[model samples]
Target chain A: MLYDVFISPFAEFEFMRRALIGSFALTIGAAPIGVFLMLRRMSLVGDAMAHAILPGAAVGYLISGLSLAAMTAGGLVAGCLVAILAGVVTRNTLLREDASLASFYIISLAAGVTLVSLRGSNIDLLHVLFGSVLALDDDTLLLLAWIATITLLVLAVMFRPLLLECVDPGFLRSVSRGGTVTHLVFLCLVVVNLVGGFHAMGTLLAVGMLMLPAIAARFWCAGVGPMIAAAAFIGALASISGLLVSYHAGLATGPTIILSAGVLYIFSLLVGPHGGLVRQWAPGRHLEA
Target chain B: MTFALRFSDLTLGYERHPAIHHLTGEVPAGDLLAVCGPNGAGKSTLLKGIVGILSPLDGTIERVGVGPREIAYLPQAADIDRSFPVTVYELVSTGLLREAGLFGRIGRGERTRIEDAIAAVGLTGFEGRSIGTLSGGQMQRMLFARLLLQDSPVILLDEPFTAIDDKTTSDLLGLIGRWHSEKRTVIAVLHDFEVVRKHFPRTLLLAREKVAWDATQNALNGENLLKARRMVEAFDTAAHACERAA
Candidate 1:
C-alpha cells in the first residue's frame, strides 16, 4: 500500500519523476519570493503579474510556436511592463497601486485570451492556460533549476536591504539611495519567478504556488527567516504529495500540486502556530496577562 | 559652534501650494530648538524639508557643517508599520548602515555599540523580541534605541511624545537632555506648551511663517501666541503660484 501510494509512482514512471523535480525546483525558487510578497502585502499584485504575462506568452507562442526561450522572454517583458506601469501610475496619478494594477491586469488577461484564440487551437490554449508539469522536458527542467539557483543566490545577497524595505522603507530611504534600486531588483525577481512558474504550472495557477505556501508558512512562524524556510518546506512537501495524487487519481498535474498547497494553507490557517484561529481562541491568549 | 542649518526664503509644500512659505532661519550647530505651532502651521513640513525627504518650492536650505548622513530624523508614530516581523536587535542594527554599507560585515565594535544603544534605551533583555510584540511605549523605546545607535550630529524629532505615557515621555526626555549636554543639535516639534516652557531653551513659534524665533519664554508670549493663531486662521487657502522677483 505504501509503495503504491508514495514509492511506485516515481519508481515506475519517468514522467512522475520529471514532474516531481520540476515542482521541487519551482518551490525552491518561488516560495521565498512569495514570502516577501505576503510581507509587503503584494500577494494580489503577484496574481496580477502572473496574468499579465499571459498575453506576452501568447505573442511568443504565435511568433515561435510554443518555444520555451521565446515564451519566457515574452512573459518576462510583459510582467515587467505591467509592474513598472503600475508603479508609474501610482506615482504620477491619483490611482492607488492596487487600482492601477487591477485595470492593467484585466486588459492584459483579455488581450492574452484574444491572442491565444487567434492562432492556437483549444488544446494549445488549454496547455498554455493550465501548464503541463507531467510533460516537462529536460530543457524546461534545467531552466527551472537554473532559475531556482539564481533566485536563492540573489535573495541571499539582497536579504538585508529587502528585509529593511519590507520592515521600514522610510528608514531605508534615509540611509541609502539603494532603496529604489532594491525595489526594482525585487520586482525583477518577482517577474523572473512568475515567468519560470508559468512554464511549470501555467500562468493561471503559477501565483498559487508562490502565494499559498508563503501565507501558510506565515501561520507557522513569527520570524522572517523561519517563515521563508517553512514556506519552502511546505512547498516541497505539497509538490511531492500533489504529484503522487495526480498520478494515482488521474487528475491534472499542475493544479493538483497547487491544490495540495492550498490544502496545506487551510490547515495552517486553522491550527498552525503563529496566529492560527485555534491559537487565537485558546485560553491565556495574551502572554503578558 | 558653526551654523548647522540656514533656511533662506524656503517654501515647502505639495503641488506648488506652500504649507510653509518664505521662512528664513538659522540653527546653530549645538542649539536645542523647539518648533511650536498651531494646526497646519507646517512644523512637520519644515522637518521633512530638513531631512531632504521634501524639496523646497523656492529658495535654498544650506547645511553649513553637517552632511546628509550626519542627520537623524524621527518621524511621527503614524509613519511606521509596527507589525512588520523584525526583532528589536535587527531594527536597531540598521542604524549602522552608514558605517557598514550594504554587504559589509558588522564588526565586534559595531555589535557592542548596538547593544549599548539598546541598553541606553532600556531594552536590554528585549533585544530578541519581535517589534510587533512591543507596546507603544516599548516600540518608541526601540526606535530611540535605533536613534541612539545613529549618533547623528543633528536630530529632527516630530512629536516624539505623542501617544506615549508620562513615564516613557520623561525617560525619553532625559535622553534628549543627554543629547543637549553632548552638544548635539536638536530640533523637535512639540505640542505641549508646558513641556516647551520647562525643557526647551529655544523656541521657533510658527504660523505658516515665522511668528517668533527667540528664547522659549519670549517666543511663547501671549501676544505672539495669539498672533500665531490669528495669522494661521487668516492665511489664504487658494494662494497663487509664488512669483520670484528677478
Candidate 2:
C-alpha cells in the first residue's frame, strides 16, 4: 500500500516523473525569491506580477498556438514591462508603487482574459490559467533546470547588496553604487522565476508555490537564510505529496499542489516554534536579560 | 583653514519646491558643527544634501578629499525599520561595506572590528539579539556601533538624541567626542538648545535660509533664535516658485 501510494505512479508514468522534477526545480528556484518577497513586503506585488504575466502568455498563445517558447517569452516581457512601468509611474507621479502595480495588474488580467477568450476555447484558457503538469516536455524541463541554476548563482552573487537593500536601502545607497542595480536585478529575478514557474503551475497557482511556503517558513525560522531553506523544503514536500495524491485520486495537479502548501501553512500557523498559535498560547519561561 | 565641504549657492528640495534655497557655506575639517533650526526648516534636508542623497537644485557641493562613500550618515531612528529580522551583529557588520565591497570576504580582522564596535556602543551582550528586540536606546546604540564601523571622515547625525534616555545620550556623546578628537568632520541636526550650547562648538542656524553661521554662542543668540522662528513661521508652502536675480 505504501509503495502503491508513493512509488507506483512515478514508476508507471514518465509524465509523473517529469512533473516531479519540474516542480522540484520550481521550488528550489522560486522559494527563496518568495522569502525575499515576504521580507520586502512585496507578496501582493508578486501576485500582481503573476497576473501581469497572463496577457503576455495569452498573446503568445494566440500567436503560436501553445508553443512554450512563445508563451514564456511573452510572459517575461509582459511581467517586466508591468514592473518597470509601475516603477516609473511611482517615481514620476504621486501614485505609490502598490497603487500603480494594482492598476496595471488589474488591467493586465482583464486584457489577458479577453485576449484568451477572443480566439480560443475554454480548454485553452484552462491550460493557460491552471497549467498542465502532464505537458512538461524535455525542453520545458531543461528551461526549468537552467532557470533554477541561474537563480541560485545570481542570488549568491547579489546576496549582500540585496540584503542591505531590503533592510536599509538608504544605507546601501550611500555606501555603494550597487543599490539601484541590485533592485533592478531582483525585479528581473522575480520575473524570470515567475516565467519558469508559470510553465508547470500556471500563473495563479505558481505564486502559491512561491508565497505559501515562504509565509510558513517565517513562523518556523528567525533568520533569512534558515527561512529560505525551510521554505524550499516545504515547497518541495508540497509538490511531491500533491503530485502523488493527485495521481492516486484523479485530481487536478496545480491546485492540489498549492493546497498542499496551504496545509503546511496552516500547520505552521498552529505549531511552528517562532510565533505559532501553540507557542503563543502556551507560555514559556522568560529569559534572564 | 582646509575646508571639508563647500556648498555653492545650494538649493535642495522635493520636486523643484526648494526646502532650503540659495544657501552658500563652507565647513572646515574636523569641525563639530550643529545645525539648529525650527521644525520644517530643512535641517534634515540639508544633511541629506551633504550626504549626496538629495542633489542640489541650483548649485554644487565640493568635497575636498572625501568621496561619496567617505560620508557616514545616521538618519533618524524612525527612518529605520527596526522590525526587520536582522541581528545587531549582522546589521553592525554591514558598516564595513565600504571596505568589504560587494561579495568581499569578512575575515578575522573585520570580525574583530565588528565586535569592538559593538562593545564600544555598549551593545556587546546584545550582539546576537534581533534588532526588533532592542529598546529605542539600544537601537540608537546599535546604529552608533554601525557608525563606528563606518569610520568615515565625515559623519552626519540627524536628531540622534530624540526620545533617548540621558544615559544613552551621554554615552553616545562620549563616542562623538572621541570622533571629534580623532578629527572627523561631524555635522549634526539637533533640537535641544541646551545640548547645542553645551556640546557643539559651532552652529548653523537656519529657517529655510541661513539665519546665522557662526560659533554656537553667536548662532544661538536670542535675536538670531527669534529671527529663525519668525522666518520659519512666515514662509508659505503654497507660494509660487521664488523668482530672483541670477
Candidate 3:
C-alpha cells in the first residue's frame, strides 16, 4: 500500500515525474518571494499580478499557437507594464497602490479572456485558465528550472535592502540611493515569479503556491529567516503530497496541489506554535525575564 | 566658522502648501542645536529638509561638510512598523550600512561594534528579541543604539523623546552629550522647554517661519514664544501660491 501511495505513481509514468519536478521548481523560487510579499502587506498584490499576466499570455497564444517561449515573454512584458503603470497611477492620483493594482488586474483579466476566446476553442481556454501540469514538456521543465535559479540568485543579492525596505524604508532612504532601485528590483522579482508560476498552475491558481505557504509560515516561525525557510519547506511538502494524491485518486493536478497547500494552511492556523489559535487561546505560564 | 548646513530661502511642504516657509539660515559645524516650536511648527519638516528626504519647494539646502551618507536620522518611533519580524541584532547591524554597503560582509569587528552599541543602550540581553516585543522606551533605546553604531558626523532626531520614560530619556540625552563633545553636529526637535534649556546650546525657534535663531536662553524668551504661536495661527491654509518669485 505504501509503495502504491508513494513510488508507483512516479515510477509508472514519465509525465507524473515531470509534473513533480516542475511544481517543485516553482515552489522553490516562489515561496520566499511570497513571504516577502506578505511582510510588505502586499499579499493580494501577488494574486493581482498573477491575473495581470493572463492577457499577455493570451496574446502570445493568439500569435504563436501555444508556444511556451512566446507566452512567457508576453506574460513578463504584460506583468511588468501593469505593475509599473499601477505604481505610476498610485503616485500621481488619489488611489492607493492596492486599489490601482486591483483596477488594472481586473481589466487585464477581462482583456485576456476576451483575447483567448477570440481565437481558440473552449478547450484551449480551459488549458490557459487551468494549466495541464500532467503534460509539462521538456522545454517548460527547463524554463521552470531557470526561473528558480534566477530568483534565488537575485534574492541573495537583494535580501538586505529588501528587508530594510520592509522594516524601515525611511531609514534605507536616508542611508543610500539604493532604496528606489531595491523596491523596483523586488517588484520585478514578483512579476518574474508570477509569470513563471502561471505556466505550471495557470493564471487563476498560480498565486496559490505563492501566498498560501507564506501565510501559513507566519504561524510557524518568529524571525523573517525562519519564516521564509518554513514557507519553502511547506511548499515542497504540499507539492509532493498533492502530486501523489492526485495521481492515486484521478484528480486534477494543479487544484489538488493548491488544495493540499490550503489544508496545510488551515492546520498551521489551528496548531502552529508561534501565533496559532491554540497558542493564543491557551497560556500555561509566564516565563521569567 | 564652517557651516555644517545652510538653508537658502528654503520652502518645504506637501501638495504645494508650504509647511516651512521661505527661511534662510546656516548651522555652524559642531553646534548642538535644539529646534523648539509649538505643534505644526515645521520642526520635523525642517529636519527632513536637512536630511534630504524632502526637496525644497523653492530654494536650496547645502550641506557644507557632510554628505548625505554621513547624516544619521532618528525618525519618530510612530513611523516604524513594529511588527516586522527582525531581531534587535539585525536592526542594530543595519547601522553599519555605510561601512558595509549592500552585499558586503559583516566582519568580526562589525559584529563587536553592534554588540557594543546594544550594550551601550542597555539592550545587551535583549539582542535575540524581535522588535515587536520591545516596549516604547526599549524601542527608543534600541533606535538610539542604532544611532550609536551609525557614528555619523551629523545626527538629526525628530521628536526622539516623546512618550519615553525618564530613565531612557536621560540615557539617550547622555549619548547625545557624548556626541556633542566628540564634535558631531546634533540637531533635535524638542517639546520640553526645560530639557532644551538644560541640554541644547543653540536654538532655532520656528513656527512655519523663523521666529528667533539664537542662543537657547534668548530664543526661548516670552515674546518670541508667543510670536511663534501667533505665526502658526496666522498661517494661511487655503491661500493661493506665494506671489514671491523663486
Candidate 4:
C-alpha cells in the first residue's frame, strides 16, 4: 500500500517526478520569503503581490503564448511595479500600506484576468490560473532552481541587515545605509519568488506555498532562525505529501499542494508547541510562576 | 572647542510645517545635554534631525568629528515592535552592525564584547531568551546593552526612562554616568524636570523655537519654564507657512 501510494507514482510516471522536483524548488525558494513576509506582517501583501503579478503573466502570455521566459519576465515586472507603487503610496500619501496594496492588487488582478481572457480560451485561462506542474519543461525547472538559488543566496547575504530592518529599523538607519537597500532588496526577493511560484502553481495558489508553511512553523518555533528552518521543512514535507495525494487520488496538483500546507497549518494551530490552541488551553500552563 | 553638534537656523517638521522653527544651537563635545520642552516642543524632532532620520527644512546640523555611524540613537520604546522574534543576544549583537556589517564575521573577541555588553546591562544568562519574553525593564536594558555595543562617541536618548521602573532607571543612569566620565557626547530628551536638574548639568529648552540653551539651573528657571509653556500653548496650529528668504 505504501509503495503504491508513494513509490509507484514516482517510479512509473515522469510527470509526477518533474512535478515533485518543481514543487521542491518552489518550496526551498519561496517558503523562506514567506517567513519574512509573516515576520514583517506582510503575509497578505505577499498574497496581494501574487495576484498583482497575474496581469504581468497574462501580458507575458499575450506577447509570447505559453513561453515560460516571457511569462516569467512579465510577472516579474508587474509584481515589482505593484510592490513599488504600494511602497510609494504608503510613504507619501495618507493611505496606509494595506489600503494602498489592496487598491493596487485589486486593479492588477482585474487587469490580469482581463488580459488573459482577451487572447486565450477558458482552458488557457485555467492553465494560467491553476498552473501546470505536470507540464513543466526543462527550462521552467531550470528557472525554478535558479530562482531558489538566488533567493537563498541573497537572503543569506542580507540576513543580518534584514533582521535589523524588520525588528528595529530606526537602529538600522542610525548605523548603516543598508536599511533602505535591505527593504528594496527584500521586495525584489518577494517579487522574484512570487514570479517563480506563479509559474509552478498559478497566481492564486502561489502564495499558499509561501505563506501556509511559514505560518504553521510559527506555531512551533519561537526564534526567527528556527522558524525559518522549520518552515522550510514543513514546506518540503507538504510538497511531497501533496504530490502523493494528488497522484493517488487523481486530484488537481496545485490546490492539493496548497491544501497539504493548509492541513499542516491547521494541525499546527491545534497542537504545535508555541502558542498552539492545545498549549493555550492546557490547565495550569498559564498560571505557572 | 569643537562642537559635537551645531544646529544653525534649523527648521525641522512634517509637510513643510515646521515642528521646530529656525532653531540654532551648539552642543560642546563631551558635554551631557538634556533636551527639555513642553509637549509638541519638538524635543524628539531635534534628536531625529541629529540622527539623520529627519532632514532639516532649512540650514544645517554640523557634526564636527562624528560621522553617521559614530552617533548612537535610542528612539522611544513605543516606536519599537517588541513582538519581533529575536533573542536578547541577537538584538544586542546588531549594535556591531556598523563594525561587522551584513556579512562580516563575529570573531571570538566580538562575541565576548557582545556578552560583556549583555552582562553590563544586567541581562546575564538571557543570551538565549527571545526578546518578546522580556519585561518592559528588561527590554530597555537590552536596548542599553545594544547601545553599549555600539560604542559610539555621541549618544542620543529619547525618553529612556519614561516607562521603566525607578530601579532600572537608576541602573541605566549609572551607565550614563560612566559614558559621561568617558567623555562621550551624550544628549537625552528628558521630560522629568527633577531628573534633569539632578543629573544633567546642561539643558536645551524648546518651545517650537529655542527658549533657553544653558546650564540646567538657568534653563529650568521658573520664568523661562512658564514662558515655554505659554509659547507652546499659544502657538497657532493653523498658522500659515513661513516664506523662505532664499
* Interface RMSD, per-candidate values to 1 decimal: 1.8, 1.5, 1.4, 1.5
Looking at model 4 chain B, report the run of 10 residues with the lowest lDDT sum: B232-241
Q: Candidate 1 clashing pairs?
A: none
Fraction of native contacts under 8 Å reproduced by each candidate:
0.38, 0.53, 0.68, 0.79
Better of 1 and 4 by DockQ: 4
B171 in model 1: Cα distance from truth in Å? 1.3
Ten-residue segment with the worst summed lDDT in candidate 1 chain B?
Answer: B232-241
Native contacts present in candidate 4, fraction = 0.79
Q: Write the per-residue lDDT of candidate 2 for residues B60-129, one digit (tens) a residue.
A: 8899888866799998654556767899999999998888877789999999999999999998889899
Candidate 2 lDDT over residue span A1-289, tens digit each: 9998899999999999999999999999998899998998899878888889988998898888788899999998888888878877876689988999899888887987787788766536677778887789999999999999999999999999899888998898788878777777787788889888888888887889889999999999999999999999999999999998888888999989899999999999999999899999986898896
Report lDDT (CA) for all predictions: 0.87, 0.89, 0.88, 0.87
TM-score (0 to 1) for chain A, all models? 0.93, 0.94, 0.94, 0.93
A52-108, model 1: which lDDT tens digit per residue? 888888888888877999889889888888887777787568998799888987887
Worst 10 residues of 4 chain A by lDDT: A280-289
- Sorted on TM-score, best first, the list reads 3, 2, 4, 1
- Which of candidates 2 and 3 reaches a greater DockQ? 3
Candidate 2 TM-score, true structure as reference: 0.96
Q: Cα RMSD (Å) per model?
A: 2.2, 1.9, 1.8, 2.1
- Give the per-residue Cα lDDT of candidate 2 at A258: 90
| Backbone clashes under 3 angstroms, per model | 0, 0, 0, 0
- The global Cα lDDT (0 to 1) of model 1 is 0.87
Looking at model 4, the pairs that clash are none
